[model samples]
Target: MNKKVLERHEVPVADTWDLESIFSNDEQWEQVAQQFKERVSEIDEFRGRLDESSNILFRALSKQLELEEQLGKLFTYAHMRHDQDTGNSYYAALQDQAYGLMSILEQKTAFVTPELLAMDPKVLDALVNEKDELQAFAHMFDQLKKQRDHVLSEKEEELLARAKEALLASSQAFGALNNADLEFPTIKGEDGKEVQITHGRFVSLLQSKNREVRKAAFEAVYATYESYKNTFAATLSGQVKGDIFQAQSRKYNSAREAALSETHIPLSVYDQLVETVDEHLPLLHRYVRLRKKCLEVDELHMYDLYTPIVKDVDFSVTYEEAKQKVIEAVGPLGEEYVNRLKKGFDDRWVDVQENKGKRSGAYSSGAYGTKPFILMNWQDDVDNLFTLAHEFGHSLHSDYTRSSQPYVYGDYTIFVAEVASTLNEALLHHHFIETLDDKEKKLYILNYFLEGFRGTVFRQTMFAEFEQLIHAKVEAGGSLTADELTREYYDLNVKYYGEDMVIDKEIGYEWARIPHFYYNFYVFQYATGYSAAAALSKQILEEGQPAVDRFLSFLKTGSSEYPIDMLKKAGVDMTTAEPIKQAMQLFEQTLDQMEELLEN
Candidate 1:
């Protein structure tokens, strides 16, 4: 019999995260929350007086950071509490209260930016030089200055801020239609039992060993998307147009430029990724050809891509085993790094199992002052083991950054966010491949690594390319009608997957299901991050202490340096194509190993 998910209270105390460390109890949270709300007005006192003196400005910014840090802890605790048991009404209310407090804080601090912009540059420079406290925020002020050309007047800024909700209408409508209203067809499972398709179950269904089940699930999903093609097209077009409008309003040359400018990433980095990956398309094609051979199918289709090229091999790893494996896997990072990871494991920094109404996926979450905690709805599988290592990658990154940098620079940007996580995964992959003696088990691990690389690097690069094309098309006075969107997406798939795999007609509707298209050129980071991680992981393994120290330095630098520069410090120059090339070399090496193993 399958085990029943436990109630929140019934979950063992040791297995749960020590959230009481955040606040001894709910009553204390309530008391702190009230104090936080009362202090919201404290920011308004510095509103008009920001230009008074450097010391005053320094204290105002410092005070703002202090309040923000408090708000972060408050929201983090409330959301984690609610996530642990979504059915609990009290925590739900607390989460809502935290959100409300956040809005108030934002509203009160809205004047700080415009007021700073209004100050004389010479005066601000003098102030910054005058105060030692102000000097710490020198990088932050420089970043703000870069926005001087883009920023509008106080009145105009307010107008744009107020229009934020209206701007999100198209994306929100797509979410409602795609998530709330769409109905998927029921199909027979591997056991010949009828199972209804869901967004969550769709990917697993495609991974089914039964080819017929995979094909049916694929068709059913695309058919639903096909029915709503025109509507989806409209929503997507609106979202793209809104992005362009926002970009033009801010004087950015294009939506892509505007999106990338936030993280100081150069357009060449993105272009180089596409160019390098395009040059290495044969590597992916070779993998697809291998898949065709391994499956021994008459023909390969897009739907067949997700199923394991290697059949079942027992790789079950209990949570305890996963923890130990993770610690061992990261051993190359040095004793200090391993010991920090051990502290996280021992100090109850992870919530390790699923219970009724808990969150479905896993993540690392916490504020600067609190322990960086991980949440998991874990299972006894290789995937869970990798996930444990992946999340600890993030938690340790957070731990290092918080301990090293001030609160203002504690959190890193999203561009470099995945590097540490994916690097950990790379390390774990290496650990498994080196340690496993059984060929079948090693093959399973090899297939897992290839699938991850395919999804992260190849697939996401394709997405980034498509995002660029769509925005450029719309900017050049073209409409993204259903037919246009479908044709472009289909052609791109043909280019990326090569002629070995048959591109299905329904695959044109695949773009409709991706919500990231609305994310304003954000998907490229996945491709870039994975490439950096692969390269950095290789460096750490081959070069030992020097590479590991550089990688650790990148983690601790946080937002103090530009993301591109941070990766450079870690010995991966994302500006050049070397990282992507290095990653491609790894993929080719792995493919060669897998083919040799199967042949032997």
Candidate 2:
């Protein structure tokens, strides 16, 4: 029976996150709201005075930063409240108001760019060199110059901004449909009771030991989606076209280039990961064959892929237990790092569970003034224990950045964010394996690392490659008919999974269900980050304090440096194949170990 009543959910303590720390009461937030309105209106006070001199520019910029910090606090607190319980209309309404206010604020701030652009570049450069505070804005200002061509004429920029709501309709529509409207087929639990299906529950269902339960859940949920796939595909195609239109209008070579260039990520990073993963496809094939042999099944279908090959071993670490376990796992990270981590968890730095209508999945979030908090839907199981460690890794990273760096460099890019989180998982796996003498426990850990590679590295790369192909097709004026999309996705699956497994037709429709496809070229980072992290984790384990210091330094960086350079400092050079090669070697080693254990 579900512990949650209509008003709230009973997520495990570790699964619960703390948002109350942001604002203890609605009255406190309300006071900030009044102050925010007053401060926001003051933004125009220095507008006409901005061009007077370098001091004038700094003054106006200072005002903008003040407003930003206030607004960031306003919105983060409200959004976190809403995420805790979407059914709570008080917080939900507060969130919407904050968001609408933020949208206006964003448009208001757009003038900052045009205003800065209006300044003489030489004068601005001199100011940056002269003033420490002004130096912080230099990266943002230079980034604006890189986007000058895309900025449009003042009148045209306003026109485009005015059309933003209409232009974003397709992506917004996808969100509403997927999150609010689209129906999912219900699944039967082991108790023979029906349960509402969800994205979070979908993976849980696949891990069910009962084959009938797994098959019913898999087919039922997707079948509901299959019926409305054409609609989903239409919305998705519109989003793709929107991306291509934006990229082309900006005079970029492709959507991929436009997106990656913003982060200044090397195009070779994308290409090299695809190339390396493809080169190593046979090893994946071998893993699949081993899965078949161990399961004693002559054929493996896509649905059959998720079930574990080794015997189940329970590792139900409680919230308190997980806290200690993760600290022990990263003890090599040094005393100072571990102590800060302890402080973060002890303080209300996490919001850990799913309440009614709460958002799906997990993330670490905060503003400059607040604690970096994590949100989760933690179950009382081994996987949830790992998720606890993973998110804490992110929280600790954010904490370090906020504490050590100025607000200007407080937030890191998504590219490096995943690296920090996944590294914790790798460390926790190592820690668990070293402590457990039981072979079953060892195999369980091995299975997790194996699945991690398959899901993060192998599968995300496939999605990245597919995303590139379809976008190119769209750019070439070719329409992506549902049949063609399926065939292409299916063919790619066959090539990746190899001849060792049966390629289910339903697996082709999997593309229609994946939400990440809408994220343009974002999926590749998951694969790259995971591989880089595996190598970095190995370095931290083997090299001790120097590597640990370098890794922690990477977290402290935030946006102070570009992602590639920051990661390079952390000892994983992602531009080449060595990190990926090392990661694959570890995967192979784990696979060999698992196979030997099963044989014995």
Candidate 3:
């Protein structure tokens, strides 16, 4: 019999995250919201007085940052509460209220940037040097100055700002449709019992030892997606068009360029990732062949890629055991790091189980001044253990950055965000290998690592390529209909996995189901981040103390520097191909070991 998912309120109190840290009650949040609204009107007083003096500029900037910090707390608390149980109407209204306030705030403060741009460059520079407060925002001012060319006239900027909510409608619709409305048919489990498939459950089902179960789950998912293919295509097309509109409005040559420029990442960094990954496609193909050989299948299909080749090796890890193991895995990073991690574990920083109406998957999320909280639907398996460690990496990163930097620099960019998370996974994998004495378990670990690399580096690079292709197509006066998207996606799969494996026809609709494709060039960072983490983890394990120090420093630095510069300080230089090359080499080495173990 299939187990029933519990209601959010039915979950143990200890398993839920403590949102009370942000606000004791929604009544308190409402009071803060009213105060924030009144505070927002103060910006009107400094409207055109930015160039009068450094003190005036500093005051205006400080007020903006202050309001932002308060709003962050309010918004984070509301959204998280809503995510805990999407069916709760009260929190849903709270989230809507929070988003409405954000929109109002954006319109209210839209002129600040244009006014700052209007000031003379020399005058702005002198102001920064003259005022201590201004000096504090020197980096912010520098980044603003770089956008001088892109800053539109105040009227145009205001118009664009007002259209922000409308422009995001497509993405919002996709999320609602995907998460709330979409449903899959009940598929048979490994034990031949009917199991309802969910976004979270799909992953575990794909890894099942029973081929029949995996095939059923895969087909059920794609079949459901196929039914709504036209709707998804329309939503996806709207998203792509939105990206193009923003890029064109900002005077950027392409959507990819516009997205990368937000973090000051060079176009070459993206190009280099694709180039390097393309150069090493053979290693991925070799791994696919190895999978085919080990699984001993006549033909390896798309669904077979996920299940382990080695059978009957129980790698289940309870959440309690996972906590201690993760702390021990990260021990090389020093006592302070491990202690902070333990504090998070003990203080209820994680919401650690799936319930009915809970958001799918896991993430680390919180605002400045609140505990860096993580949400997980944890399973008793190695994957979930790594997921716990990964999210902790993000939380600890958040913890350190919030403590070290001001609210302005408290958050890191998406380009570098995955480094800490993936690094933790890599460290935990190393720990598992070293500590486990059984060869079969060791082989499973090795297989797990290779599979992760394939998914993150190889599969995501393919995704990055597809995103670029689709965006370029739309930009060149082409349509991104279901057929075009499906064909392109299928071709890429064949290219990446090679002719050795059979690319199922239903797999062509894969693009229709990817939530990331709507994310506008955001998928590439996964590949880049995985490569960087692979290199950094090797350094931490081999180079010891110095590498640990650098890795921790990287986490603490946050948005203080450009992601590229921050990563360079930690060790990897993303502009070069060395990191991706090294990661591929590691993948190859792991494959060789797995092959040897299987043979023995």
Candidate 4:
């Protein structure tokens, strides 16, 4: 039976993360915020003096970084507190205040970049050579110089900056509608109990062994989205339009180009992922066939995709057991790494229970000055165990990066961020399969691994393809009405999942509900990151200490280099199709093992 979700206050103190480290209390936070507001003019003082001397430039940069760090701390705290219970008006107001202050800060410091860009390249280079402190910003300046064509005049830049809030209106509206207003109907569960569908509960219901329950839950959730299809389509269309407008305003050819250029990733990498995954569609079809056979079903519907084919395995894992298992699983990373994991586990770094009004999913989040904290609605199951390990991966990555690099480079890019988290999940899976001796248990574990690969690599690649296609359509002046979006999505589903499975028409409305589509070409990184993690995990398992050293170096490097360069140091080249191909091969190998185990 499913347990009742608790209120945030009802959750045990030890089960919650300690946010006091950010500020002693809300009073202190308010004081700091007020002081920051009073000192906002400090950065404005360096307005036109950037070209005067290297020391002046260094001082200005230092002040800006210092203020940014403080703002990060304030904003991170406010946002996380708000996420704890979004209905809390106090934290909501605090979050809004922080956002407003951040916007004002941006406006106040708007002249720094354009002023720096106004200087001659030779003059800037000479200034860098004049002071040792200025050397840290060499890459920053180089990247700015590269954007010389895109950077507009001072007034234009300010106008664009002011337009950011307006441009984000669509995304903000979607979030408000989806999270705060939209509600799914209550549906009968496997036990014939009425359960209100929520984002958190939907996953568990989809994986139910009861086909009736799964179908009911699936229909109920999408039905809500279908009712508001026009609204969702409008929001998504507005978002895509915003991307196109921003790209054109900055003189880029397309939205995809502008998005990828931010991370310095080549357009070829995105194209290659879709192409290689397309080549492997037959493998996915084969797996679907296997799934159909394993479940002894005549027809496999989209709702059946998440159900476990292997049953009665008792794959329960408690939070305590998960903690020890994660430590042991990551033991190959050396004592220091394992010790840090243990520290985070004991230091109340995780908020470990689901509660009413809490955020639906899980994530690792913190500022540079605070502990790397993780928020989870943890379940005592294998999936939650892997999630625990996954979040720890992010926390540990943050821990290492913040400790090793300066605040300016403390945080890693989202592209490389998933590599560490997914790598941890991969390592935890390996540990389970090797250490568990029971045949049925091993089969369950293997199934879990395959399901993860399918969701991360295959499923996310499908999303990537859809996102790219929609952007192209918008760029080409095509309409993206609800009907058009649904047709395109359904066709892509058929192409990716093959002819064996029934591509349920309702699943096409799936695009109307995904939060990531609003993220503007960001979903592709999940597939790419998983592929990189797969290759890196293989190395760590086979090559031992040397590979671990390289992976550790990757964690510490942070944003000091480009994301692609950082992954290259860890020995994974995402530009080529090798990593995706290798990940596909591993998926096939796992399928083979599952087939053999079932045959025996």
Among the numbered candidates, top TM-score falls to: 3
lDDT of 3 by residue, 1-600 (tens): 125677887899999998998999889999999988888888888888998888898888888888888889999999898788776779878987888778777887888999989988998889888887677677888888888888887777877877877777787677767766787889878777788998778878888989889889889999988888889899999999999998899899999999998999999989999999999999989999999988889999999988887789987789999998999999888899999999999899999988877777898999999999999987777788888999999999999999989888999999998999899899898998889899988988999999989989999999999999999999999998888888899999999999889999889988887888888899999999999999999999999999998988888887888899999999999999899999988998898888888888
Better lDDT candidate (1, 2)? 1
Predicted structure 2: lDDT: 0.78
Give a tens-digit lDDT track for model 2, residues 250-348.
678899988788787878989988998899998899999988887777778787777666655555556678778888887878898889888877786
Question: What C-alpha lDDT do the candidate models reach, one value each?
Answer: 0.87, 0.78, 0.88, 0.88
Ranking by TM-score: 3, 4, 2, 1
Model 2 residue-pair collision total: 8
What would you estimate as the lDDT of candidate 1? 0.87
Candidate 2 regions exceeding 4 Å error are: 1-16, 26-38, 45-51, 87-93, 130-132, 163-168, 315-317, 480-484
- Candidate 1 structure quality by residue, lDDT tens digits, 350-404: 9987776665567899999999999987767677788899899999999999999
The 10 consecutive residues of candidate 2 with the worst lDDT sum are 1-10
Predicted structure 1: clash tally? 0
When summed lDDT is taken over every stretch of 10 residues in candidate 4, the lowest stretch is 1-10
Off by over 4 Å in 3: none
Clashes of each: 0, 8, 0, 0
Question: TM-score for all predictions?
Answer: 0.89, 0.91, 0.98, 0.97
Q: Which 10 consecutive residues of model 1 have the lowest summed lDDT?
A: 1-10
